[model samples]
Target chain A: MSASLPYAVHETAGHDNASMTTVGFWIYLMSDCLIFAVLFATFGVLVHSTAGGPDGKGLFELPFVLGETMLLLVSSFTFGAGMLSAQAGRKKQLLAWLAVTFVLGLAFIAMELHEFSTLIHEGAGPSKSAFLSSFFTLVGTHGLHVTCGLAWLIVMAHQVVRFGLDGIALRRLACLSLFWHFLDLIWICVFTFVYLREFL
Target chain B: MKAPLPHSGMEHAESHAHGNLKSYVVGFVLSLVLTIASFGTVMTDLVPHASRLATIVILCVVQLFVQLVYFLHMGTAKSQRQNTAIFACTSLLIVIVVAGSLWVMHNANVNMMPMSMSIQSALKHP
Candidate 1:
């Protein structure tokens, strides 16, 4: 009975190019948010359950963490700037900004891994206590996302080079944009509740 | 009525693409300053524990919001409604799980009496 729908209607209502990407990216963000939410909950429950070991007060180094946070936040901004350049079809500018974003994100992950190594060296390994375990899980999850994002950025760069401003390419860029920004959002909560709350 | 797929191509073309890179820089510097301030609070013990904690939390929250609005363009017209809804739901779920678990665990510890206490002592001693 419904075989003869208008082409425009079919294009709009069914799987149009733009909405498909937008909706898919939104769904991805939602799923990613759920994962982070789980991590946040894990951290929250165990924040005080130190299991007779050092707690946030004793373990958290705010200066180092602050530096890491800055790195991530700035990188998020740079990524947005890169997206802006992409939208404008400014290939050189986009590439430059994307490179900056990638470097900053890498730096952030390096600092975090270094901090973890130092903590483990200082006898504050995740096995030391539940608090540390949760801390590692939450922060490590974020680092992992950044690593994936860096990989995705590389792939997207290759696509941009090969395809220029094509529909599928733009959609992928949009998805990456959402993913990067969502990571920033998650970090904000981690910084406030996990690191900053020690002082509170 | 079938809605036409909102062609991102047209939107992409129409949208003014020059980013507020200057604002991003400003936000970045501000975030750095806030981070430093929080660190200072942690290291120096200059403020009372409660006050310092509150200050740091507030600063972090504010800084995060700054990052979202300035850097991420979250809550912008493009995906604001959907993004906000997702965030709100996730946040609510987080609260329920975290708070519920903490409460349940605390109560269980209290009810179980010497079990957790003994465990705590045993770990402390061993």
Candidate 2:
């Protein structure tokens, strides 16, 4: 059965190539998801093991986190707009939307860094307790992914400017859109499991 | 200066793009509503404490599917079935690992030796 196959299917090759890239990116996302799952499990296990330190109830600032969430969420939406622009072959619109998304992404990271610094200054540093340690690792990993994503966005924006809406640029933008949306998905889980669950 | 993308090849892509943009808009609005709902449920004292956890859990799951279908285009005919299959398998593995760890660790904490008991015995022996 394996030997009888023909491999000369160039008619559908473009679609196949696009789907192949998407599938590969999906696998990457799944692996990233498992890493987060491990981190979340660690947080669940140690959330109560505060080691005589402050817990989530004492440390989390809901309003600040809500602001951060809004920023990231809007950025995801903007990135989707950019993808739509790319598909429609609107180069200028694509660049404009991408620039907006990048700004929102930067703002989100700035807020996150400010929050982290405040927590550390207030003696709730990761090393101070098991709860904080798991908290930092899980949230920090997500922050790192966002940082990388910001960099990717800049590179892709540059490519779109140089290449217009070529096949390669469209494919790359689609993959990045998936990555950006995946980050939003992960953040939803983080806020639900890590932040909101604290109040519960 | 450069010629526009081929009309024939992109006809399908163009139509799909318009439909996809609508989904993105719908997804964005739905996600915002869901976020507000979760936040309101958690912050307000509307629901009893006992059921609050379950409420948020259900909300999270619902929001997850919303984003998956609308934003990620997970179930659309345009998306590849193989991608969906891989995602389903990945989700199963994640559930097993996360739930398994929490279950085992929770049981361990319940059955473990008391820190006070361990400390006192160590001091006495020394």
Q: After superposition, how far is residue A33 of candidate 2 from its true place, in Å?
A: 0.7
Score each candidate by Cα lDDT: 0.71, 0.81
Give, for candidate 1 chain A, the lowest lDDT window spanning 10 residues. Answer: A1-10
Query: In the order shown, what is each candidate's alpha-carbon RMSD?
Result: 6.6, 6.5
What fraction of correct interface contacts does each candidate retain? 0.49, 0.61
- What fraction of native interface contacts is shared by candidate 1? 0.49
lDDT (10s digit) by residue, model 1, range A132-151: 99899988988899899999
Give model 2's TM-score versus the native structure.
0.89
Best by TM-score: 2
Q: How good is the docking of model 2, as DockQ?
A: 0.43
**What is residue A150's positional error in candidate 2, in angstroms?**
0.3
Mind giving the per-residue lDDT tens digits that candidate 2 earns over A1-200?
11122112223533666667777988999999999989998998899888778989999988888899899989988988887777667889999999999999999999989989999999999999898999999999999999999999999988877756677777678888889999999999999999999997
Q: Which residue pairs clash in candidate 2?
A: none
